[model samples]
Target: LVAIPPSLLPCWTIHTSQWSLENTIRRRPLLQLGDNSHRHLNPSTISVTTEREEEPDFADHNTRRSEPIRVDLPKPATRASTEAGGDDFMSSDQPRVVESRPSALTSNPVHEAEDEKDHGTVERPLVGDQVRDVIRLIQCRKCSRPLQEPVTLPCGRSLCKHCLPETHTRENISYPATPNRLQGFDCPYQECGRNHAVGDCGVDVILTKAVDNFKAEMEKARETITTAEVSTHVVIQRPSAGQTGTDMDDETTSRVVKGGPLVAVYTLADSGELDYNSNVTFAEVSSLGDEATAIDNRTFSKVKESVRTEMDCQVCYALFYDPLTTVCGHTFCRSCLHRVLDHSTYCPICRRGLSVSPLLYRESCPSNEHLKTIIQTFWADAVLTRGDALAAEALNRHREFDIPIFVCTLSFPMMPTFLHVFEPRYRLMIRRALEGDRTFGMVLPQRPRTANDTHFVEYGTLLRIVNAEYFADGRSLIETTGISRFRITRHGILDGYLVGKIERVDDISIAEEEDLEANETQQALERYESAATHQSEDSSTSRPAMTTPEDLSKMPTSELLSLGVSFVERMRQQSVPWLAQRMLTIYGECPNDPALFPWWFASILPAKEYEKYKLLETRSVRERLKICCGWILEWESSSWSLSDCRIF
Candidate 1:
């Protein structure tokens, strides 16, 4: 058995010895040398030797080594290098040095120098790249195009061309492109090239801003030009009083010339210079505030070159003069009111029912009429002074022709057909008509009423009274036929009745059939037979054949008249009671077409006053036939039972 010494015993027991003891000895020199120190070691100065005393049970005698020699020198001022070949100094018996502080020097000086370099060293600013990239990525906000140059906004942002100034500068400062700032430019990007403002550097920032601004300015200029070109020119027609082409001998020759009114209202800016002598009526001047200014020699030249143009009437598009308000509270020019009443009895503005007879034209209008008389008085005076020439000039502005007109007065009554009883005045009208050429012109009254007085349609047919009968009530029932459609040129009250200047419409009559034309005669005969038998329940009432010239002439008139009456009666029989009712209500006993025998018969047969009025106003014979046919067709299809039928 081997005896173990106290120090040797610790080495002999496996659990008592440190496992890192050899590793610590080998690595101890590296830690003590610091990270960058260099070491000098010679192989001859250190030697290893083996010594044998007694062999242990598990020990290899050949592997046993002598402890290396230890040397303690003053610690080096610098650390050692791993690449200095100093590994031979590390051994188990020699203690290794431990480092107390990190070394200042490092082997990676090149890498450290690179990390310390400035981040701004990149020659070009990323702002320009960012701007270009952003502009390219986003299409134009307005026109949606990528081809436009990017505008470098003062907000240090960029946008495509064609953006509005309001959109860009609402909150952010925006730089506009102009020549004033193009020479020296500042980077728009914040903190980029902070030494320069937009006009201080040479980076062409000013040029970019200028280009964008120029494009916007050009667009504004183009809009102005387009507006000027598209504006409506006022046309004034001035007629020289009493001047005719045939009256060349007259010294004070009156001529008609057309031009716009001196005052005009404009809503846009006008950049063009004003020329008073030129034909242009008015031009827009400026849009400084909410109000727009326009220039005409008469109105704007005196008021500091800018004045509010008068508000125009909504109906006439002219400065309101003598404005009148309807009961519906709608305002219109006095002249416009007159014209509207000629066409319709309703208010022009609200389309409400109106009584023209009570309409009053006065200087003071209703509260809703914004325009006062002060303005109107001045405008009216100006118009009267200037209107004659203007009207003459405007005369050629519209095509002119003489229009035939007709006028008639209502007369007589048939129950359910005509609601109105014959008044005393219309009886006088019939007596007057009988004393004349049996013809009377129909004219609409100046004012219409819903009740008590007569109202006539604007266009009425001329009437020729053919037959008359005196009734017990001192009323006269007259049969008449329509002559032609006419337009009333002028109307006036005459002898308690309406009288009018009416031009007669010349009829283009179809050629009359010769006596030898058997086919026409047979057709006429058949038409007469159809008319006579149209509504007769008794076959005995069938028309007799006409064999004489007088019969031929009279037969057509009788047949046409009978046909019109039969058509009405048939409509009433076929359950289309409305047609009979309408006819009765319109025509009454008085003939509708009092001038034409056939139309007069048609009107008297239908009891309605409105139906008579329709016949009186109907211009074309063909149209009358069409209307009659429609009624017949409607009657045939209806399910209403037939009632007592009688001719008036």
Candidate 2:
């Protein structure tokens, strides 16, 4: 629990003794003689004096400005109040003055003095004065006295001259492992408020020095820890079972047999499901025995036959395993199709030229309708049994967990492809998300396909759906904010959509430092404001006025990027090569780069998706900065040389 100082209390105020004459004056309004006179004066008379006359000389002559008017009147004989019905007249006019001692409301020096004494010893210093005094007191940690001669330590502490020698000695001699640097020194003063090591001064010099040393030590420690942790977590790959000796293999085989019949049979059987013997060829099963026996044999034979037949390519009437379908509705097993196209194009079925290359079966036995059904059944069963396990693994691996997956717009081999069709389950998922978090993770397939494909970038940001409107055509327009980067940990098929587990990554140090530095840099950038404003003023072309340092600092990073982008464009249009180059150098070529120069340039230029993605994915700020600087330099040199040569 942190204790807030009494001085820090919201309503704490200095005592009366701490108040100065100026403070008293500010708190109480002055009683003005003019105000009193104004309040007592007749309103009509006041208005007549203020009102202007049409003819000043005539008005003045008629008004008779300063004389008092006197009227002759009859005098009445004076009589004593008792003789003239005393009580009623006395009560009606000339009321008697009641003599009373002054109340406490009136100011009195003695009473004020007593109140001041009761209010406690005059605070030694007012609140503002106390703060300054405290600051002086805290100046030098070693001396525990006001810093008469302030000196800075590399650790950023300010120390008095008297304490510097002792601190320096301790800093030099103290072992790196020692936790206490000021063990030998006692408190600098007997009446010190807090005891501290002589070397552990809270002065700016000492503090800064200590901080630098500490940072160096921490860096070394971190490196060691990282090396040790990484070494311990090394992953070793085991050799294939085929590489082991027969004796070892046989032993493993025996263990499998002991484990279970299913394991033993699967271990020995090719394909793990079927077996063949001379006496039981697939072709000889039809001729087997009498009516009942023959019926049973036929049934079994038919099942096997169906399996074998489906294994052949339905389009070619050959072994169908690894079959592929083209966009033109032509189907072929993998090898046959590769041969027919001659590594070229055109569909074999409809004779329509296939614009896309050969497509591989996304699923095993894709051409077999029965096989597809069987596979789906098995897949559903597997999902039912192991979905929780998969989800848990994905979570641990930092992949998207429990969400509908979509395919990439572009396809490549082994890459997950997005289908044009949005299934009901996925629509439900989207609806649920919009009603709730309104955010989702996207993950790219390890291998992308080139044909009608589904692939995404490896790392993606959390997209916040800002607006979503369903159109009459049944499409949605979604506006989103990219929040943070995430990495995919695992992926699996769930009801025909991809499901993944994703983990969020945060780089705090860089982000915070960048923010601070950006603020400072923006202030420094204000020096260019005059140039910008002058250029704007001189030009007939309309442009935004130069932003103030304070305004630029207050703007969001994104808005700043936009401003920089716009400035760069205007400079380019004006043929202000130096300004354009400077802008390009400052903002990197990419969003993730130290600057946005390159990205801004590329935004104006024609760049491929892959090229843009490369820039977006480049995470190193230093590298991005270097790249932008290089581009700026090249552009500058070329433009300068060209301009010089043109003088001829």
Candidate 3:
């Protein structure tokens, strides 16, 4: 071994050491660091000679042109020749053939693997047919199952992946095996409780290959036995002692004629043209005659039991309906898995991430072909059972009304509302709504004394969700427009959400007499206001008279209309200030019709709830108009009084 200089020491590492200090010093020349005389010892001084190939100018159809990816590959190690220098650990001179390869000095097992893979010289166990026996013998000797994706340790024994116990690394030695620190995982085989770095413990690839080959061989052997049984037939004959030549010829001809049809029938059965009972054929009942009847019955019973267990869904604990296997290798009923993924993008049992792309468009996940075939082949009855169960469930859901309610802020007809659905109950409620009618009622909650006593208002606005965007965590942003107002007749909880049996609530129909009276009141008020304005010296151009309670009986319909119309015009002109502009922005220009104008003004005003509630109670348009006019007059008088005080 040659000593490296301090300047070059950082560039080179001591990869391997096999000799004692005394022996190594005697066998190799000693070089001191930072010595100008030993500048040759510097790694920078050594020139590497590599054969470079010129890149092709033209692009190759099969290859992509890109910069060469840099890899930290370990250089192959070389042992000194016997003639040049003796082995430091050897007493006698002997030459041994050494395969030049990278030194196994990497602390990271993953890097060690990459080096071997790039060099293409993987170490494999030297066992032929014995590989099968080796794997079986090394089985999680505790449970006695064949080694599965075996992890071999220094003990030379293998353990199934799951049988290995939790491991800990040097960093945070108290914490058990975690995904991030798995590189330094320790071997947990009972017999070999050794802390083996993950990459150091090579997987049993050779054993895996051996096991696969053994299974293939067994399958081939079974196929061959079945083919032989179907093709081969035995025959026996005994000649009658007192048979005439003509009688024997006729008997032989008749037997030969019947054999043709029998051969054709068997051929048709083999080709699947005949609908023969496969179970009977499998048990060789026909070939073995009546003696095989008992054996066939027992075989059929065992087969039915195995099929029932294998074809059942783990999630529902029932027969699989459209079986699907997730990326995590767990099989589930397709409908069951779809419902799970609607709320989550992970496998229910394993919590492993599952691809949600298919489910997003409501497409079925990839089916597990093996499970599907098994159900079709040995247990078609399970398919029928699953269908029956699904139908019954659907019927039950149908029997119950599926109105989903959203307990949120108040909404009104023709208004747009945006909502963020994060709560689990609301998320589910939205999904059910989208699945069925794409409509849900949005209601405000009423004040309750206790949490459990939460109740919503009787009347709510039904909203039709136009579009919804769902996030990965089951949160959704939905855009909805108010459909119509509905009054809850009966309310109850369903699936963690509020539901109500509701009837649509329409605006009260206005009577013709009420419209005529509203006109009459407007005319009378307009005349009385004109007469009072002529008599008052303080009258302004648009300002009207402040009639007393005594003048109420004499007021005419026209003057009242004048007051209401002037107030509305002032609001639209932005001259009269109001607290809220939300309704002004949303509803645009106030309605001009006498019948609707009063109700529209009442709804948009930022007035007391009791005042607005009173507006809804009045069925007559004239009455509502009267109430609104009084409110406007009161506000006008209050503003004037405040100005008069400020002037004084």
Candidate 4:
């Protein structure tokens, strides 16, 4: 009833003349040139101003971006709308509603939907480029062709599987997803130009099917063209005078000769309009054809349900949050695949070796982007529910304290520790850790001096896996960085490796009393430094008293850190080869930050493993630093060397 500029709003409305119920639409740009350069953008809120008491949601049906492009919608327009289906398409019953949802296509379908049947699902003929848009959605954005066995990358984009780079793919070497992130090509999408690695790629099952449908549509269109060209013939007439071919006459038509070619005859006779050339075109032909059945609300729901079934992870028997596909052409959820790989490198469904495909790279791999887009497009509510459930599950994972423990040498927070995963049980533990949160407990075995002593020390550091390189014989060399300390509440062995229910070990905050203690320690350290200078100068007096662990422990955190820093400075002055500039670059120089200095000192200190575990037992930063200072003092007093302090 009203005419207005199309650029006023961004709603894409379907024609309601064919069959009116309601249409599925989303908020998309009418004309976006590149990036944020919108042609006619006026992003201001527009709501219905009807003379009603209150309106819970003032947004019209046009601005909703809830579902995918293919949608059948609107349940019923009722004020007391309890149904989720009906809530989406409810527009105001007054004039302001039309302006609220300005259409880019035709007029607003809401008024046209008033004179309609069928429960909320509007049926409109797929006209113009709508059918082609469906085909475009599945096409490879890079190669400008239908995706051939499409592989989804972490960047939420896809290209042909054959198009993936093969430079880093090797059989027995380390995984690119582990030791380092693999270098990749520029992203196909203009919106995202960042490089995405092939090591983080997964086969796209849903897009592959869409490509097949696209192929079928092409074949059908060609057949239609061939039939149209070959199915008809032309009739000609021998004109007596300079006259063109007229209407059919029994006598005249009987004596007429057959035409050479239909096209040529049309050209010679100068036909007004050819029936074949009237209006039909290949681009205008809908992929589903004229006989395409319109889907109602119930049928639309059933279709999504069927697709959801395909999207479910077989291992978890739930909706796939991040689905991944293997080189064996099998697709499964990322976490599910992780669980399967824990036992063997073979695919669970196909029993084919998965070593050919890149392993799960949590830091880089984002699983199947196409599948993820489809899931979010179709089941926005379900995805939110799934995300919440997974988050809770991940939180419970840490809180429940059913953690895998690695019985190894001592480790400290912010310090790196390398381990050789030759033992079968520890390999499984590492796999489980990588799959989950990339963390596990690291503790030293007890000396068993007392009968009450446990198999391993109670206190340990939680190691977060940084990198791992695998061997063909099911062994791996993992580089881990310590996260935090933990104390085991209960312990037991599962499948040969230890599993523990542990509580976190954190430092006691220092107060004024500790500051006073630090001042006293500072005076004592000054006295010792003078005494050591005197002893070195004289050569007749015995060495100054060694600072025992107990004495150093009583000192404040500042004193301990100063002692360690002084020791490192003295060692560097003496030209200790490992403390050279190159070594410092590799291992990092003595950190000026007090919170980090103790761990760095602990990592490089040439103390015994048993002695190092004492650092884990303490809940005070002062005590930990004191332990490191004590080791340096002991090393100096005994004239011991740090020749065995290897970087490995």
Q: Find the candidate with the highest lDDT and give its number.
A: 4
TM-score of each: 0.22, 0.26, 0.30, 0.36
**Candidate ordering by lDDT (highest first):** 4, 3, 1, 2
Point out where model 4 deviates above 4 Å. 1-67, 70-72, 76-133, 154-156, 162-210, 213-310, 325-330, 338-363, 381-385, 388-399, 403-607, 610-648
Off by over 4 Å in 1: 1-438, 442-454, 461-485, 505-601, 604-607, 617-619, 641-648
Better of 2 and 4 by TM-score: 4
Task: Give one digit per residue, the lDDT tens place, for model 3 in 142-223.
Answer: 3444345655443344555566665554331211223432455555545445454443344444334433443343334334
- lDDT per residue for candidate 2 within 1-648, as digits (tens), equals 011222232221122233233233221122221122211212222211111112211221123222111112222233221211112112232332222111111111111221122211121111211212212222344543334434432122344556644332222121111343333243343442222233333223222232233233323433433332111111112223444222322322112111111111222221222111100101112121133232222222232223332333333342332234443333454445644543234555557554222322222112322222222221221112122222332232221143333443211111111122244655654565565555544433345566433355555445444444344554443333344445544445544445544443322222223334345445444454444455644343344343233444433343344444554555567775343443333322323322334444433332243433443454433233333333333333455464443111
Per-residue error for 109 in candidate 2, Å, reads 67
For each candidate in the order shown, give its overall lDDT on alpha carbons. 0.32, 0.32, 0.43, 0.49
Worst 10 residues of 4 by lDDT: 32-41
Displacement of residue 598 (Cα, Å) in model 2 is 7.2
Report the lDDT tens digits of candidate 1 across residue range 208-311: 33334333433343344344322223321222344422233422211111111122211111111211111122222333211211212112122211111322
User: Which RMSD does model 1 reach against the true structure?
Assistant: 52.1
Cα misplacement distance, residue 244 of candidate 4 (Å): 51
Regions more than 4 Å wrong, model 3? 1-402, 449-454, 466-479, 512-565, 572-585, 594-603, 609-627, 637-648
lDDT of 4 by residue, 541-596 (tens): 23324456666644445445656777787777778665766445434789866658
